[model samples]
Target: MAPRSPPKRVSISHSFTSFFLGFLIPCINAAPLGPESDRVIKLPNQPATPSISQFSGYVTVNEEHGRALFYWFFEAQSEASKKPLLLWLNGGPGCSSIAYGAASELGPLRVGENGVDLHFNEFAWNQEANLLFVESPVGVGFSYTNTTSDLTKLDDAFVAEDVYMFLVEWLQRFPHFKTRDFFISGESYAGHYVPQLAELVYDRNNDTTRYPFINLKGFMVGNPVTDDNYDYTGIMDYAWSHSVISDEFYHNIKQVCDFKELYWSTECNALVNQVFDIYSEIDIYNIYDPKCLINTTSSATANKIKIDGFKRVTILAGGYDPCYSPYSEMYFNRPDVQTSIHADSRGEKWVSCKDSILNSYNFSVFSVLPVYEKLIKEKLKIWMYSGDMDGRVPIIGSRYCVEALGLPVKSPWRSWFHNKQVGGRIVEYEGLTLVTVRGAGHLVPLNKPSEALALIHSFLSDEPLPNHR
Candidate 1:
């Protein structure tokens, strides 16, 4: 077998946290400072906000690494005290869930095109459960490490370990949620993150003597990159069937490559690049979404922007701009915003996905399928969904992977409805469920917000999706 080349890295802040115990102690009837007390005091460009309370801060995960992970929590809009909690992660092996998951994908407020304003997202996931987004593994976004080597030493196992500790400390900070019904969710590279972290949680949950059990119920992943065989088959099929590649190009993909080797063969390198070139001029993440027309005048300016991190490729926001990366850079860079969130005092530029970390990720499991199988057997509510239009992590690959899971069907595949219209398809196999959101892309919630909300709402509530009327 030939040596495999490194996989391409694809991929995502805030808070003031110094309140003397006396600060809260002064009140006549004061509640102890809980994690919720890390509430966001204000946003740099916040608009008149809704009623939901929000929080942003760091949770130290590794003392030796001087590592800390950042998180943002949006309490459920109503009955938050009684609602379940959902942890949202974004997969980059090196990306920030805070930037991509919270800000652009499903968070309550999105950055407007002007880059200085916030707008409400009607279908924000907080409507269904209290949502918590974390920037993990010690090198992404507001998360950081004091040791120099720690910045580059990140992988799935390390990420899972750090995240596990993050949850422990987080709940300690907010003891009330220690027993709250909790679930894990994420997308893309997160296909690796959610399962591994859940495995740790599951193991600890079985030990009754642990300090806290984490009330873990189950998990969900969207457009995940799972086993190479199934993913390759699905990605090729999606591209060819969708006419994103020429018949010749599609033939090249089939004949010139052994899909199982995924990412390190000299023979398939040219063919792989050819396939990627198909969407070079478009947003490959959402093949159907409009492309960003970046207007850079000089190399110096472009280089500076790239060095500045998240805005490396400037895609201006418009309404809920389908473009995800650029607006994050604009909004997160403000000194005032950083102060409000109590972000790093050094004023370091933020990057959505850290190249330093990805390059140094020497560790990762080959596949998370075994983990999923175990979780399913354990009777966890394992759900998976994909946006059909995403060329990056195509829905075809997602569906194919689900079928390969080898579980007996509990419910025949069928259409799900919302607002009396066809929203998507659903299938159940014993303990796991598979879903596809019609007309959506890589970022499902951002593409089809209403449908995405319905999907999550049904999963969180443990109910069958509405049938086609």
Candidate 2:
């Protein structure tokens, strides 16, 4: 067997942006340049404010399917060349990471309530790492497969293969980041995405002569659905614990249908509908977050907040407004926005989650625990986090999944803090770290930006979550 490659050394100094760090320093243009000269976004809302650069384009992942994945990259605010490269993905199996991740959660500019305007996100992850958001698998966001057949099926296996190729080809477009410390990150369904993709990198990196030797370090995920069994059980536990549903109903649902059927199958459709009916009053994504019933009407002013539920959520939460969804759709669907970002518009418009794709998606592996077991043996840095308020993939489920690994605890469960307040709670295991963000739901960065930064900094820096007893 070829000798395993030595792990690359990484620098800990991070780029800080106001979004994540409470302040922004001008980005130092020290990295080798590519794609910036052509793909810069002149957003219709805020055209000239940002001095920092961004890149967006397509990289063909499958030639036979004529499949190409779309990506948007945000360079760090400082020392661009030296920072680690972090890829961000959103779950939904059928969702666009560009919309949910870059637009609402951690992008430089978040879509305002009207859906067409923009505002700065004070906690964009690019402040600390070079952020790359990809629309993976195909048929999600701007990524597409040209197969004329009406059937659409994207499973974990195909996602891994296509994304692996996407990264290989994407490097050809921007070669400077090839040797930089690379990490994979995603949320929700990306729980599956971040790991499956990382396993490929971990396996390939063992090759002595693999082209471009991707300098992979480790990975992080938030509110991930790692194991279908554990995730389903976790959500049920979360709902019951949070008083969202009755114990009798929870047990009845479990007795009637498997969690895997929650999304598909008529076997338990009526029963699942019962659970959803109780969950109907709330935003299943962030149970506590107020709902935005409609998109903001097209308006002339960037600050003109929408009248419906979207703006109300923003006003009530005082941080993340669930209303960003409609606005993101509006902005991304614009001809100018598509042209500015060089988006492919084979589809009518971008939906945050593509229902058809989610319904038609082929289930490959129910649990990534085996993959996790192998990667753990390899000693890769892995962190799992959850928004405490999020019921969809509750912290309880993620905690149960990690504990199933049975890794020894390096640090006993404790509260971790930022700015002298309880940021979250953390428990460290021999091979992984588990975190719960206080008052945060599925979207940690959007809900608790500072804590999210603190968490990410700890992961990227290879440090323990501060022992704020």
Candidate 3:
């Protein structure tokens, strides 16, 4: 057997922005905030004063290891105290929730194109629920650990434990939110993070000896990575059905590739690599969307070139800026911005997705289906949504994963409307509901904010997606 290569180091290139504005504020000592200290007075380059209260700081999960996770919280626009708390995570298994979940996707304020300013997102998720975004694990974003070995020990269990710890301590710091109905949401690899963490929270809540109950009512994930077998088979099928690859190539892959295998043969790897090579030319995240021509030098493209011997792709029509990733990296890395957010005081450079964390992250769990099965049996409200255009964790794969659950159909699949037009389709199962966001890609909120907002509103309300306009 050919020896496996060492994991490639992934680098995300920065797009330089010259615009700068000077803002001065009194220097406060860098420490995890008391309820008041964490309040964001103002952010540098903010286009307009914010109306809603925003708080950001670190919550130490492990005192011995000096491990802390950075978090940004936004209160609901109208009913600040009454809304449920919704924790949003972004899954790269290493991606910063602040970058994808906050800045680029559903945050109340979005990082502007120049990376030097912020703009209000009218359709932000906080419109319906208090939004919380965290840079989790020990090494992603501004979250850090004093012990370097902690980085190497990262895995699903490690992440879930630390995050639960963060939640416990965080609830202590903000005691009022302890009773709010809580729901966890994220996309991509978060498919793993969300369920695992939810299960952990569920188990802990049931423990009579445990302190500080987390009011976790339910969770929602989009384009989530579920079972390896289903995801693999679905990817190839989606690609071929979508005409992303030729029939000859698709048949060749079918002949040489066995999606059920734990490891692929070298020939399978070569065929998959060729598939990714073609995906490289397009924005695999959103196949129909134009590639961000601005930062062609970015190794972010290279980082996605191979997904452990499988390829992912998608397409979307234009409107959203594809350069949001680089812009987020540049904005968060700024000294003033970091200070305003009460991030790491040492001025450690921030990246949207940390390559080190991704490289070292132990992909020990092959499937989260069992966790889903466990949770489904409980009286928890679970919903899964997929961007139909997201090739990475395509709707096809999500459907397959959901189908594998073998739940009775509570509602037949039907078109759901938004703006008097068919937004996508929806169906309700015995213990789960699946929705599709039409025209959206991997990042649904970023790709289609209005529709995404509507979807979340429905989920939080426990109502079905609008069947008619």
Candidate 4:
């Protein structure tokens, strides 16, 4: 494979520095002193009033290669000092948590229409925890590496290591959060990221002699990419069950495709491509939801972007505006916005998802079931959730992944409620919990913010989802 090309390098203009300092100093003094340099006083188009304390800046994960990861940390909306810390990551093997997690989904501010302003997200997850969003690896979002070779070598292990290092150094910058209960959460490709990073943190926590301890309590993922065999099988089954494809199409795929193998045969790929062709017509991320019609890259283009044999659709936030990804790109790439967030975009413009990173990422791991087995034994809280309407990493696949574990049922599946209405369903296994968000697509928080908030509250508190309406 050819080495991945690096983003262009750009020098910051001298005039921007003057504007940055002039705009930054007043807000800096208003916030508390810890990691003050990274404190974001205000965003360019944020509401005139202040809400929560936010810090955004770079944390170097590798000094040798000049690689650094960018992070935006939001203190809990209230009683921040007493709340646990939650780290959110978005999966593309190459997407930015800043774009999906912070800008659109659970962050305190949602980028407004046309990417010209920001509005408060009432259901922001920080209301329950100190939310931290990172732009990971060496080439996603504002994160970058001076070593061009780093982009080509991207893989699960590489990402986990860099993220782990980021956490360690990030904690050093704000030691108060080091001992706070920490949890990792994300959706989609994050299925791979959240678990792998949890395992690394779990293993490293045991050997504090060489690493700084992270108080990792548990993790949760939504519509995660788990075992390849189960996920692929689930994809076809889901498409058929949901009536996304005809019975004949489904039958042909099952007959020609052997999902158990690491690589699909040409016949299977061809069959799958046919499915993608149909999926392109609808929002594959959320089958029932409308596609972002105005966006240049349609769902067809998104379905073609894959890592290894796994399909990775373009990261989109589902809600009032279907084109949330483009808005994020427009908002974050603004020079003033970058200056406010201390983001140096190198020469390349910020994008919600980077195709180059997805294309180059080495998909070496076939299954994370082994990691799941190990972590379950360690008594860490593990929860898997799915937005039932999501066709990409459907609840069907998540169900199969959970069943494969063969854990005894602690609690039978039952409907869970929020706001006097059915929120979703939940089932508890001996070591894990599986949840489904009703009327939601791939990005649950974006689609059903209230219910997603309720779900997280239940997860973090280790309490049952409300059985009564």
> 315-352, model 3: which lDDT tens digit per residue?
23433887788778778877778889998735455778
lDDT of each: 0.75, 0.76, 0.81, 0.83
Predict model 4's lDDT versus the native. Answer: 0.83
- By the lDDT metric, which is better: model 2 or model 4? 4
Global CA lDDT computed for model 1: 0.75
- Local error of candidate 4 at 325, Å? 0.7
Across 1-469, the per-residue lDDT of candidate 2 in tens digits comes to 0111222222222222223221112234554566664467567786356665888888886576688889988889888888999998887778888888898888787887666677877777887899889997688889887884423446676788778778877775676777788999988889988898898877766753433357778889999988876787787788888898888987886787665442434645665566667887888878877766654345522323346533244445537776667667778878788888888677465677777877766665667889889988888888999988987888988888998899998989999877888878888899888888988888888877778887888889877777763
Which residue runs does candidate 1 get wrong by more than 4 Å?
1-3, 6-37, 262-264, 295-320
TM-score per candidate, chains pooled: 0.87, 0.86, 0.88, 0.89
User: Of the candidates shown, which would achieve the greatest lDDT relative to the real structure?
Assistant: 4
Model 3: residue 188 alpha-carbon error in angstroms:
0.3
lDDT of 4 at 118: 94
Candidate 4 lDDT tens digits, 22-115: 2212232233425778999999889976577999999987787999999999999888889999999999878899999999899989997566
lDDT of 1 by residue, 181-290 (tens): 99999999888889888988898777644334678999999999787667767777888898888898888778877877646466676766767777787878878767
TM-score of model 4 vs. true structure = 0.89
Candidate 4 stretches greater than 4 Å from native: 1-33, 296-319
RMSD of each: 6.3, 9.5, 9.4, 8.8
